[model samples]
Target chain A: MKKLFQIALGIIAAIGGFVDIGELVFDTQAGADFRFQLLWAVPVGVLGIVVFAEMTGRVAAVSGRPVFDVVRMRMGLNVGLITLAASLLINLITLAAEVGGAAIVLQLLFDLNVSTLILLSVVCLVLVVYFVPFGGIERIFGYLGCALLVYVAAAVHLKPNWHEVGQGFVPHLPSSALYAYFVIGVIGAALVPYEVYFYSSGAIEDRWGTADLNLNRANAALGFGLGGILSIALIVVAGEVFFDPHIQPGYLGTTALGAQQAFGEAGLVLALVGMLFAVGGAAVECAFSGAYTLAQFAGWEWGKYRRPRDASRFTMAWLIFFALAFVIVETGVDPVLLTEYAVILSVVALPLTYLPLLLIARDRTFMGDHANGILGNVLGWLYFVIILGVSLAAIPLMLITNGGSV
Target chain B: MEDKQMDLVYRVLDDQLVDIEGRRCGRVDDLEFDGSLGDPPRLYAILSGSGTWHRRLPRPLRKLGERIFGTGVSGRDVIRVPWEQVEEISSVIRLKAKARDLGLGQGDERDAALVAKLPKS
Candidate 1:
């Protein structure tokens, strides 16, 4: 019973930590634009995250090397450097977007100035990271982030057509460029590289070994599976409340209004609170992921398990990233718009991130018996191809759609 | 036979380097070998630092990376861990000396000194 409870908590934390500013923005916008038509992309992307996360998580647990370390070892110095540069840039932008999004949510809830709140958010996140133990940060944010379940409740309460909702699961060729853009957006948002970097590194920090392989699978499957359900709920709620072509949700506040339409003032407050913790959690992950990648690649000692004083460069990297993120967001860019670009641009980094993990996970020398099984190999390569295609289309689609505005 | 058996590029180069106390020091950024061209070169040392790794890049990026990171160590831009110090090479390259004794992680130490001056906890 105790073991089951611990596993349940792990899965719940995973689920809570899954959705970030990118998923919230893209899922909500995709739903408002195409209703249930884009729903197929959520599960597709969720399954992709599960497959890759499970593989990479296993690699971390078995070998004690995280994603970036594998990138350097397998991809070599030149290609590894390029990948590191690309991922770090994307991580920075995503970090800024999450921090900005969290500030916006705080502004909505407390009616405070966004600039001031942005500073506050970064400070609090730094403090949380400094003072909170690794598991504490995960559980605190994860448990509170479950507040996003209000979207699931709102989706059902709005009472959409069940038949149409079911049909959304069946894939269809998007008839227009806008539809195609959202398709890429939803997938890209879900498959952001930071999640893998953070998760694999977290596995190492938690001291996962061969014994934790099943636990890794459970966390990836159930945690991400439930998070995908919340993403679908976001789309469903937006589809019902803002189905009109004119009612596009451009702001984080407008997205929360979907819940307001269902449960009024109380619902709005809950949605805002959920957004606070979820987006804040994402901001924390982004900062840590960036630090992890840098420290891991440079072969510096890193892990929140160590005191900040103990892991000096690693500590400095995250602190500097948070400061940089604050500067980027303070330029008055719309957090939602910044995240849209971050999501789309992130697709370009997806292939580079997943390819090394796929190669290393299948190697018997590295993984021993825990190497990718037949099923794992097939799914891993299949998603690699899909991610490659999505990356190829990502930039051109962004250009043609003007960041998916059309 | 040992040289033929172990794929240095696969197993040694770029693997994490852990000191005797099990603290992570750096990576095997480059390797040094002893012997003339016609003779069979034997592994001599494990080279680590931004300088050594950046040298593997194309010249243009190499210059830029050097400019950004500045070679390494005491103007050499890398620290050398003699092949003799290697305790084992498995998932990580475990060394038999302390990181300080190996001259690895000088940058980390320097930066750590600066970080120590800040208010922590």
Candidate 2:
């Protein structure tokens, strides 16, 4: 049971981050416009994430340094500072979005005003974070996020075509403008850069030495791969219920409702629980990643394990950033807007964050005898080009498609 | 000569620095060169802290750092170590300079800058 529980961590972090606001919207949007045509992107993204995440994990385990620590050391202070600021901005924006997401969920459940719920959500997150010990934070957030597996169960209940679904294993793009837009949405979901930062930093915090190298590989390959599966299930459920009816996946209510078509009332409850965990985990991650980037850059003592007094600067940076996100969400800004914007920016920031890991992972000087083997180097370079391509494509697609609106 | 201990600059260049009794000081930020007659040019002092970091920077970065760090301006940002004083380096370090003796007691120099800023309740 302990071994099983330990293995659950990767799935949990992936679910919390992937099934969170950005993904719930991205998958649903693709389901409505393109149906199973975009399903291929899900596994494609799974492969992409698995490649880079494993590299990041291996490098961290071998080097005894987290992602940002290496970035600052190898890339020099100036480039590190620029990337740090960019990553922090993405984290803060995602934090605001998660706060807004939780508020929207409350609005659905209690019939309360979203503004009031936003404030309440902010307070709740802050309190949860305040008493949360460093070691326990990841576990709690990850486990709770696993409740998102309900969407998978619901998709199975819908009895999606086994034959057609298998076809997605091969890449095939639809010629329609709407389907092309959906492909972009899928890429956005699969390659979000924050996942890289959070996962690699987590590896460092746990101090997984070279002995833990296989553990790192297992975590990345299984954990993120499972999250990608959950994402595809969400898309299937949306395709079954909302596709023919012209319903779009824009709000929290609609996403839960789509699952209801398959699993009935119980599905709704599980879906909501999943949403709760997803947002909760994402919130904790973004807020902490914000702090991690800054502390690592300035070479301050930082981590959740350390006391508030010991890591004062790290603690204060996150506390202030969390407060700022709370304030932003407290305004009437839509969580959906925040989520979509965050995902796009996260994709755009992809190459910047991953390139350093790719370079460091393959660098013989840094990794010594433990450097990425031929297979890792090939996969790493493939994802490097893919990430660069997507980052360049993001802004133009956002403008040309007007944020994927057909 | 290999049997004898090396100077802090010669040995600890790009190495982490610790206090006299052994605590983290930071890193070797810059080295002071004092080459005089008849001595194999020994390092006179070692620099640590943002002050030494500033000296190593291009002019623009130095200005930006000065602006952010409140322009105390000069070598005070660093703690210079004379070679005779360094102890040893390992996982942790032992230094010849005490926490207080290395200008730390004046403003508590050896500790982290953020810790120094904290007010006692």
Candidate 3:
């Protein structure tokens, strides 16, 4: 029963932790613009995340080192420094966006000022990070985040033509640059670098070892798989409800109304609650990922599992990250807009992060008997190539589409 | 284990260095060798810290990194752990000595001091 509960909790965390401000914003925009035409991108992105996340988790469990550690080790100082600089910048932007996102949700619920809410969001996050145990943090946000499943219900309730929904799964070129931009956005948002950084480090935090390999695989598959389901549901909800009215959801409140449209007041309340926790959880993830990346790269003590006094540098890193993020959000940049830029830039930096993980996971000296096998290698290289293509094309696509505003 | 021969670049260089208590200390940013040209280069110490990494950078960036993270009075701002002190070489380089014992604790100490000034929970 204990084992079963662990697996179940892992899956829930993955699902709830998967969708952040980026996904909520971009997936909905994709639906509003292309009406499910980009649905294929979600699964493609999910598969890519699962493959690399599994490799990352395996490396952590077996070797007792997280992804960023391997990245710095395998890539050496010069190349590793470049990767760290890029990832850290993207992480800060993502952290700011998530804080801003949580603030927006609070505003939607209470009609509070955005600035006040942003400050409150940062304060709450600091308290949570400082006082809450790792497991407590995961359970509180991960379980509450399940409120987002309301989209699943909302998507089903709005029952559109089954044929059209199925057709969305077929890959096809978009008719315009804007549609193509959403395609890249959906994919980029799904496979953000921070997810891998957080997941692999979380494995080490949990004290996973060779015995936990099967658990790692199950967690990545079920957790991220359910996350993909939520992504698809968000797109479906937007396609069914927003497409008809030509309403583009540019705000967090607009996405919640999809729930209101389908399930009335109850749905709106749940949607807001869900967005609050999901985005809040993402803020924590991004802040921790930044600290983790820096600490790992610099070879400092890290992990919430360690006492604050024992891991002071790690503590300082995260606190500074939150403080900086709060300052950025306080500047009044739109949270959703920040999320768009962060995700696209993250897409451009994807290969720098994953390429080293791919190489290390296959190295016999590093992974020992747990090294990537025939199938893992084939899929790893294939996705490496695919991720490379997306990284190269992300900037061009974003430029041509003018941040997907075209 | 006596007959075991491993490639230094593959096994040691750039690997994470962990203390005996399983705490991470730093990475093997550069290696020091004691032997001359004709002699097989004998590993002397494992070097770590931003200074070591900075030294590895191309000439221009090296100067820039040095300016940002000042070089120590010794002119090499690195924590050098003698290779003899290494307990094992596997996925990570485990040292028999604690970080502070080897003077690798300066960074950790500075950061901890800063954190101690913050309001505690």
- Sorted by lDDT (best first), the order is 1, 3, 2
Clashing pairs in 3: none
- C-alpha DockQ for predicted model 3: 0.65
TM-score of chain A of each: 0.99, 0.94, 0.99
Score candidate 1 by DockQ: 0.73
Q: Regarding TM-score, does 1 or 2 come out ahead? A: 1
Give per-candidate clash totals. Answer: 2, 2, 0
- Determine the backbone clash count of candidate 1: 2
TM-score of chain B of each: 0.83, 0.60, 0.81
Residue A340 in candidate 3, Cα distance off native in Å: 0.7
All candidates: CA RMSD in angstroms?
A: 1.4, 4.8, 1.7
Deviation from native of the Cα of residue A323 in model 1, angstroms: 0.4
Q: Give each prediction's DockQ, rounded to 2 decimals.
A: 0.73, 0.15, 0.65
lDDT of 2 by residue, B2-120 (tens): 55765543335544455665433445555677877887876676665555454444687887866664343334656666656667654223578765576522232333355545443
Ranking by TM-score: 1, 3, 2
lDDT of 2 at A89: 86
A166-230: candidate 3 lDDT, tens digit per residue: 99999997788788788889999999999999999999999999999999999998899888999
